[model samples]
Target chain A: MKIADVETPALLIDLDRAEANMKRAQDYADAHDLPLRPHIKTHRLPRFAKAQITLGARGITCQKLGEAEVMADAGIADILVTYNILGTAKLDRLADLHARIRIAVVADNAPVIEGYQARFDDPDHPLGVMVECDTGAGRNGVQTPEEALVLARMIDAAPGLRFLGLMTYPPRDDRVGARLAGMKEAIEADGIAVREISSGGSPGLYSAHETAGITEYRPGTYIYSDRMQVAAGLGTLEDCALSVLATVVSRPTAERAVLDAGSKALAADLSALPGHGHVMGHPDAVLTGLSEEHAVVDISACKDFPAIGEKVRIVPNHACVVTNLFDSARMIRGSGVEETVRIAARGCSQ
Target chain B: MKIADVETPALLIDLDRAEANMKRAQDYADAHDLPLRPHIKTHRLPRFAKAQITLGARGITCQKLGEAEVMADAGIADILVTYNILGTAKLDRLADLHARIRIAVVADNAPVIEGYQARFDDPDHPLGVMVECDTGAGRNGVQTPEEALVLARMIDAAPGLRFLGLMTYPPRDDRVGARLAGMKEAIEADGIAVREISSGGSPGLYSAHETAGITEYRPGTYIYSDRMQVAAGLGTLEDCALSVLATVVSRPTAERAVLDAGSKALAADLSALPGHGHVMGHPDAVLTGLSEEHAVVDISACKDFPAIGEKVRIVPNHACVVTNLFDSARMIRGSGVEETVRIAARGCSQ
Candidate 1:
């Protein structure tokens, strides 16, 4: 079936651009000597995860145990869940996943490490526990290098756990390397080997080499560069591989029109750019507002305003969130659909 | 299962509060002499939709054909899709759905009506079509009452379509009744009978009586009031039936903590409130930001900060979009879960 045959407000992933994106990131990481560990949170499809592994990605990074479980079920051998896995129920699943494949997780606090210590005790498959440090990005991590050492030491002492490395969702700055290096040295000075210095962010992917001491790069959004990534100097609109195919259902006024896709389809995240997303081939038009099922666009400056029922592809502000919005996406080779792929780990947010 | 037994970052609907909310809306509409056509976009569950029907609702309103199809399959005989149903594939689906149940659709443009006219020629199953008037809301509607008459006349003239009424997502104003009355009179003068004047918005549900011309009220968010509803003066925090049951997975600093529910779960729709959501029992704590799988909370003013592993219930800014974010939700009575029900129409964005 063609684009018109499929329903509107569906996800369309350009295979041509996506393959180029994968090869480019893989090639850059290979040249820079940084082991690429692609995060499956962006695509969430096992097809794409397996493709990343085939392209020489060392392993995969999941945001939660639920996501890791989907990847593991797909026969993904090595997985690293980036969040601090707390609570008994999730830890139970972590242990189950651990028994099957090589699993690693990050911890930012003592309680999380203690919970991990209680469940895991196998020497043969000691769970690699990494210390997530706050090297500048203020999301989830220990505040200082001293705190990283404390967690690293605690993880090293646990019989079921092994101290793997230091990880950070680093700020896009030159000092990211120095900040991560400080934590790595503090932990290594205590006799624990800091094997991997994992730093990640799609915006900072090309500048991975500048962050000198990082052993691996874990960029997620590079696979489908969006409007947000373009705003961050990642690439142009041409490099974006994913878009929401929407239909213009209402033309209320000469200057105003509404698309079928809204916050539920295109998502509600706004970038530094003007609108919530970039409307391809309609540069003059701005997406003024979005309700649940309608995206109102201002087409005052448009030379040719879209007629009612005209299909338009919109590149969302944030690509990762959009991936989670749909269960399945159309893989497009040029303008034709190659296949429909399920986002296996879409809502696995444990 | 109990609240603690379920995993983190899941949608929870307090069944007691939800039933109370349903009764309140039905009772209010009965008292105000307005027929209640509850919009199923907020709940998206057949269980709740059937409950609403059982509680004296005239019919259910759906935002899309896909949502209507789900409700129709679940034994809901009467459904009004409050969207401009365009395109051949969707019209084909509409025709199939129309043959099964009593279906009505709204349109603001001639193109949408023409498409319906071309496919539907069954005088026995003539499509019920309504002219959607702007009436001061800038979303999807005809600009003026004159334009509404044109569509209404066109719909009346079609052999396979009947001019049912006029509908609007009206602006919260005292003049709503007058605007609707003007449209009704204009259409009636053109030799077409205007049977139903439908107006919707949970914010304006209480003042629905003041809007003189409207015969029906379609309040969606009243079933699960959120921070947006609270901001709109619908109810207090006690009336909110739905919330994201999230776990505090990271305590980065004394002021900053992170919940497992982020944009993917809680969604990124911001209300008039200061934050993206209101955390139950944490009045001072603010949900400052949200990534895909992490909600950053600012708890500086809190006397009791949530520790890691503590489950927190967050009432999102908008309940409608949050319902679309999940596949299933736990129904709870007080704090205990009754059952898990699928959001049958979640992501049914045609």
Candidate 2:
């Protein structure tokens, strides 16, 4: 099917642009001699994950066990779950997933490590555990080098578990990278061989190599730079490969029009960006607000306004969250559709 | 299965509370002598829609033609699509739906009416058409009463289309209701019998009867009131029927705790509330931020912070949008799960 033939409020991924994006990031990783573990949370489709691996990514990173299960089912072996796996049911799933694939997980405290130890104490294959260091972004991880050592020793002492290294999400500035490097060195001084120091963030991807003692990088949104990424000076609009194709469903007034896509289609992630999304080809027009299925637009600033029934492509504020909104996306090359890839892990948030 | 046995980051609807909510709204409509038409966008389940109908709702209201198709397929004979139906693909679907069910639609402009006229101008059965009146919410509708009359006359003049009446999404304040009543009176004076003046909003559900000409009320969120509704003074936390069951995946620090459910499950809709969601039983805790599959909570104010692996229920900021995020929701009767209902209209946004 052609691109226009696909229904409105649909996700369209430019195949050629996506390939170029993957190649660009992979080249950067190769140049820096850093193993690129592309996070599949950005595009939950297994096909895209396989393509990332084929494009020279060492492995894949998943945020939840449900995502790891999807990657494992798709035959992607090496997986790193970047979040703590809590609860018995989830731990059991994690153990089963580890048995099939080479899986590594992260922990920030002793309680989380205890949960992991309970499930993997006597497994056939040892599970790799990493101490998550909190360099700057206060989402998850240990606070200091002393805390990292504490968790590292606990993982090393646990049965059927191997202390891998250290990992942190979104080391905002250079100081965080240097601090992580210091933590790694301190842990090594305690006679523990740090296999890898993983740090990740799409905003900080280019600077990831500059982070001292970092051997691996995990960047999800590099595949689809969004309005937030653009605002962060990551890349220009040309580098954004994903766009939500929406149709002008209503022209209520000269200044106000509504698109078929809303929070349900484009998501409500503000990303601290102006409005909900950036309307492509019409920078003056802003997405004023969104309801469940209506994206309210203010076109008063625009010299030209989109007419009713006309389709408008929007680069959402955060592409990674928008990817999880749709069930499948139309992969288009130029004006034609390459294929329809089902977002296999669209709601795999277990 | 049991409630605790269900996986983390799942949507759960307390069946009893939902029934109470639906009954309360239905009773209010009955007392006001107005026909209740519950919008299916809230629950999106055939069973819940059927339950609303059995409890005295006249019919169901859908936001999209796709949602209307789902309702019609589930034996719902009457439906009103509240958006301007544009484009040939969607018009064809609307025509097919009208052939199967007693369906009605709305339009605000000439082009949308022209499209409907092209398909239903000579149909086997006449289709109900309403002139969408933009009383206050400037999303989709004609601005003034004169504009409403123009669209109403166009639908009235069409061969196989019947001008049903007027409909507005959020009839804000009493002024909007008064204006819509004036528009209906003006159109009727022009020899057009405006049957069924429809207006809808959960916030304005109780005040719907205050409108002079509104004969029908459509309230969706009353079925599952969310944090937005609670903050709006429509209800309280006890009145919210839906909650996301999440597990404490990590306690990275004394103040920060992460939940397994994030934007993918809870949605990133900020409801003018302090945070993303309301953590039940812990009013002091704030959902500070959300990643794809992780919700970070600030637990500094809480006297007793939840430990790792413990389950916590969160009331999302917006209920309708949260309903669209899940594939299925667990129906609970007190502490026991009644059943799991697949959200039939989850991604019906074509």
Candidate 3:
């Protein structure tokens, strides 16, 4: 069915564009001789994850254990959960996922290491544990190389855990490779065998080859580049595949029009961009305000503002958060909706 | 089951507090002898909607046709959908709900009224249509009372529609009541009987009795008061009934710790507030940054900071958007997870 026939405030995915985005990122990783492990947080669809694997990704990366479980149900053999799985309930599920597939996880703190070591007891089939290094992104990771070595030794000494190389959500600092390389050397010198250094960020994926230490890269948002990616200079606006198909419900004035898609659909994530999203074809339309179900668009810059009942497409600021808001998405192949795809792991933030 | 056993990044609803909050709003409305119609957008639960009605609410208000349909399925008799229902798909669903129970929808434009008129063709059971007026909210509404009357005449002229009265998402302007009061007189002077002047806002629900024109008041977030409401001086911190129960996943530094709940859970609506949310008991803690799954918190103001693996409850900036993020919410009665209730209309933005 045409997107027009579908309900308003619905998520529209341009599949051809997404597939091309996938191939582009995968090709870039392939050219750099880095195995691409696309994060499933962007689309949250098992079909897209499988497609990425088909396009030569070594495996898939999930941010949460719940997401990994969903990917595993789709018969994905290799998975990497990029989170510190703590608490009894989560660790119990982590053990279940570990028993079935070739999986790995990352941790930066001692408590997380202790939790992982306590869960997995079989020394023969040791679980791969990567020491998350901060590098420069002041989010989650060890601060220094010495701290990385400390965590590396903790994992290597554990009977059930093997020390995998460093993992970093590389900071904006271009010297991230040098930092990880230095940390890897320190950890290896301290008697832990470093295996693979994994680093990722969609904004700096093209420069993967320049980063010396990392063996593989995980780029999640590459499948559906959003306005955030465009602002970060990662991809052009045409590369964005997902857009909220919303109808202009109210045009109160020539300078202002309200769309049905709001914070609930578009997400209120202002990830480095000025507004909530970018309205396609209306470069001048600024989404100045977003109530729960209404996106108030500033149409003063547009010579001819859209009228009520007209459908407009909006590319959200952050694609990953947008994926978590909806239950399903309409796949647009060529010009029309091919099928409706369930966001099987939509709210898998556990 | 204990709440600690429940997974992190879960939406928590304190049933006892929510019930008290409901009674408080209902009592205030009862004292003023005004009909109270609590908007279901905040909770999206028919059980709670029924509870509000049980406590002497006129009916429940909804923001979408899908939400009204969900409420109707749960035996809710009356619902006021505060949105301009446009397009064929939505109008079809609106008609389906109108056929089942008492449902009224608002419109600010001619296209929406035309859509309603074309679908609803029975004057004997004419659909209730409120002319949404833009007093000062600058969102979805007719520009002036003149525009409101024009839309009111359109609704009155339609054989299948009846002009209910004036409707306003009562803007912050104190003269909103006077503006709408004037609109009511002008429309009535033109021979169209104004039945109900529906006005709503969570922040100003307590002062609703002070307003002149509104015959009924609709307060949504008061049932599950949030940080935004608290900031707007609507209620105290103890009055907030809903919060995102998240885990402290990473304590990267002494001054900074990260929670599992980010924009996906807490929402990014900085509604007259400084941070993403208010970390209960940690008034000094500021939510500095929000990635998709990580909320970077600044805890420099605390004497004793939280550690990794610890759970913390956070009241989001906006409760309505947070409700839409989760598939289900854990109902906390006293100190535990009483049960999980499906957010029946969570993603029902259509």
Q: Best candidate per DockQ, number?
A: 1
| Candidate 3 colliding pairs | none
C-alpha lDDT of all candidate models, in order: 0.90, 0.88, 0.88
Can you write out model 2's per-residue Cα lDDT over B1-350, one digit (the tens) per residue? 77777888999999888998999898888898999999999899988889999989999999998998888999999899998888888889998998788899999999999998998866448889998888888788888878888888999999889999999886467688777878887898899999988989898887888778788988999899998888777878988999999988788788899898988888888767899898989999999998878899999999997788788899999899888889999999878888888999998887
Give the Å shift of residue B336 in candidate 3: 2.3
In terms of docking quality, how is candidate 1 classified? high
Error of 3 at B118 (Å): 1.6
What would the TM-score be for candidate 3 when compared with the true structure?
0.98
> What does candidate 2's lDDT look like per residue over A1-350, in tens digits?
88778888899999888889899999989898989999998889888899999989989999988899988999999999998887788888998998788999999888889988888876457899998988888788888888898888899888779999998886477688778877888898899889998988888888777777888999999998888888987889988999999999888888888999998888887867779888888999899899878999999999997898888889998898888888889999888998888999988888
Best by lDDT: 1
Report lDDT (Cα) of residue B193, candidate 3. Answer: 94
| Model 1 Cα lDDT, one tens digit per residue, A1-350 | 67666789999999899889999999999998889999988899888889999999999999888889899999899998898988887888988998899888999999999999998887777899999988878899998889999999999998889999988998877777888888888888999999988889999999888877889889999999999899899989999999999999999999999999999888988755788788899988899888889999999999997799888999999899999888899999867898998889988887
Q: Write the per-residue lDDT of candidate 1 for residues B233-262, one digit (tens) a residue.
A: 998999999999999988889999899999
Report the alpha-carbon TM-score of model 1 versus the true structure.
0.98
- Residue-level lDDT for A100 in candidate 2: 82
Q: Can you tell me the DockQ of model 1?
A: 0.86
